[model samples]
Target: MPDAPAPAPVPLDRSAFAADAVTVAQALIGTTLLVDGVGGVVVETEAYDCEDPASHAFNGPTPRNAPMFGPIGHAYVYRSYGLHWCLNLVCDASQLGSAVLIRAIAPTEGIAIMRDRRGLEALRLLCAGPGRLAQALAVTGAMTGLPLDAPPFRLLPRTEAEPAIAVGPRIGLTRGVATPWRFGLAGSPFLSKPFR
Candidate 1:
């Protein structure tokens, strides 16, 4: 007999994101991030809380960071260095100002769309970093505060075995340089440069 096909990834409920930043960051590994028909398996993430100086929520809520202070299970898209968009998943309770930055993902669907948007041929490069993944997935600041369970965006649960995860200090941060809160799927080639 032939092998059975795998089931589709399950869409996560709001309860799934009701945890603290570090817990949500590690838990996000292997989950699928969806934008329209395009999606990728999350491979790397970094946690941030209001207490962290490197966090956008560090000092408290601002007009630019209203989403971080709004609801859980919402998207917190933001511009970085005036160069690229970064995607973060809102976490913890309301007004808590916590989130998990999705740093990298392995492309799984809409390869053509992602490739065209990225203008890159290598599959691994399509969504290898936060900015690249946001670009490839067509995320923008307009999508900020949108519920992750709604149109043009969704989060699917990790259906496979618990991935082997690695932990280390987050990359590209000056204030929280020694904070070891970054999490990534071990052995995944589609990862951003590590903080070595």
Candidate 2:
């Protein structure tokens, strides 16, 4: 009989996620984010810190950002632009108001499922946008307030080359434009549209 394929490893440790913008962004560079789907969906992510004035939670707790304040490892999913669903991983227990906005992902598994969800022929477009990634990964408002350190969804380490990173203004923000907190793979097609 042929050998069975190995089961995908489970990543439950919370320390792999950092509490600061640079550390969070750097740590997520090559990690795989698994979301709910047929076999499961894998994604890459980015982060932002509370110290970042541009960050939504920078001004202290608000009704819209209370989730980020309640837990260290939770999903702070929010309805952005009155339509788009933006995903964020809540970080820092003491800070209680910092998170990393998952800006993009490079699809590694369940491409067909993603394609159907995104309704796009082009692979890049399937998960190129934040809102689209949520749709493709089956993440919705229901994902809000969910535990990030447990099942249904989680992040895995990547062995691939930690691509050269770059930082700049966060998207759709008026303040902290010059803070250069946004981080992404340099010259990668998977990266979001750069501010400049």
TM per prediction: 0.94, 0.84
Off by over 4 Å in 2: 1-12, 37-46, 194-196
Question: Once model 1 is optimally superposed onto the true structure by TM-score, how far is the C-alpha of residue 163 displaced, in angstroms?
Answer: 1.1
List pairs with backbone clashes in candidate 1: none
lDDT of 2 at 59: 81
lDDT for each residue of candidate 1 in 1-196, tens digit (9 for 90 to 100): 9989987666897788899999999999999888997978999999999999999999998999999999899999999999999999999994399999999999999999999999989998898889999999998999999998888887888877788899999998889988999999988989986434
In terms of lDDT, the best-performing candidate is 1
lDDT of 2 at 1: 100
Q: Candidate 1's error at 57, in angstroms?
A: 0.6
* lDDT, residue 40, candidate 2: 27
lDDT of 1 at 15: 86
